[model samples]
Target: MKLHPVLVLDRTYTPVSIFSHKKAFILDLLNKCEVLQYYKSIKLSSPTMDYPAPLVIRIPVLLRHWQSPTPTRRAVFIRDNFTCAYCGKIVKDNNATIDHVLPKSRGGTWSWTNLVTCCNECNQKKGNRLPEEAGMPLLYKPKRPSSFQIALNRWRNKINREFLEALSLYGIIVDKKKLPEGSR
Candidate 1:
């Protein structure tokens, strides 16, 4: 059977990676990590006690090699807050597209700095041309997102209020309004 994976954060509460339910439990049992949240509907049962399945856990040590996520279409949408970079219009996932600020013909590679979330209309309007040539200015400059930012965006749906509160305590503000309605 496929088990739901648990999110793992580092000692500083920066999201690091995902672990299997069994691994999470083993870490918790070994006192190597602490459970921050538990799955609401699942539990681990033993002869002597029952424990809620871990949904999120934090390790006691810092991560040495956290990697940033690749700039995929979904990640780009998340980074741009699902808003058209050219027109600043909020868009649903189906209506959003990735636009290369500098057209491929002009030597722009498919990198984070070149990609931006764009609406269908804006995309078509800027097709195969530089933003300047298309008379469209980007609303914000694109940059590579940190691993923590990517993790937060990628796993927002799986995270609960307590995790969000912890993020707030660390001064990380997730703009709920900017996220897609379906994502919450």
Candidate 2:
């Protein structure tokens, strides 16, 4: 599937609204919206109800902004690159789990600053124990993922060349050079 260029908010990476190819063309000319990534074309039924047309789409300009680093298991794992915070071992997405720097029982609250991604083994070994107690320490402090980072993860499967270029203009650098060989 081909990607359609979409516009996302400058720092927030939130979808404001969607634009048709015709609309995107005008916005690109007017500089009101910057493109992020292109999504696959979708067929929409014609207003006359007899036919469908494939059209390019883009993110809209009026999206809501919110805080970053929403603390959730998936978000933590993605933020930590699916690697165990203590050992640096990469884990599969499904095998990743959230670990607390400070155990909940010891007054820890579920927040981005206190959570890290871990493998099952590390989680089991460190269960309910403070990092110091478990003889483990995080390689880096945990924090919320940026809006751009979260949005990139969400749209990775649908991104295309034009979208990548557009996002670059907004300073959302995607490290194409570091992608694993053979990875899409």
Candidate 3:
């Protein structure tokens, strides 16, 4: 069966993480979490009972510690909104390349601040040189995204109006138009 992800919020209503629907359902069954919303068209059935598939769940306690995800090619691309950092051209995933703001040859570590999503042309043009050295200034400064931000971006396509509304109740405002086609 295809496993759908469920948004997980803390007691304070802050999104903390994501869990598989099955995991979220189990959390609900064990009283570990409260179901906030359910998938409209999905249902989980058993021999004795049928349950709605959870789209969002909330835990009873606040989670204080969470680890940030390591910067990766896809994550960098997503963070940059698939737009080249140097030229501002939107590129497809297949054509997107990760460029080091400070060239790797110049002792640049592969960190979030150093990496950027760039198109092949920009990558080739800025090869082995610093952004300033190549006369290409970054449009925006790159920084480490919070763990929740990473999770939200990764699961953006699965977020719907209901989930967004629930998030907004907690002061998390996501642009509906930016969501993937069907989700909006």
The true-versus-predicted C-alpha distance at residue 42 of model 1, in Å, is: 11
- Each prediction's RMSD to truth: 4.4, 6.4, 2.8
How well is each residue in 9-128 modelled by candidate 2, as lDDT tens digits?
533454333334445656655765554434443333457652222222344443345445467777777667677998889899878888878888899889988888888998999888
Candidate-wise lDDT, in order? 0.79, 0.63, 0.83
lDDT measured at residue 101 in model 3 versus the true structure, 0 to 100: 89
- Candidate 1 weakest lDDT stretch, 10 residues: 158-167
lDDT of 3 at 67: 48
Measured by lDDT, the strongest candidate is 3
Query: Can you give the TM-score per candidate against the true fold?
Result: 0.68, 0.63, 0.79
Count backbone clashes in candidate 3. Answer: 0
Q: What is the lDDT for 38 in model 3?
A: 91
Q: Give the per-residue lDDT digits (tens) of candidate 1, residues 1-184.
A: 4455577888888777766678899999999899987877667889999888887799988886666678888889887767899999989988998888988888988999999999999999898998888999888999998766666665655555544555555566778764446535
Q: What overall lDDT, based on C-alpha atoms, would model 3 receive against the true structure?
A: 0.83
Clashing residue pairs found in predicted model 3:
none
Q: Rank the candidates by lDDT, best first.
A: 3, 1, 2
Q: Which stretches of candidate 2 lie over 4 Å from their true place?
A: 2-7, 10-64, 156-161, 177-184
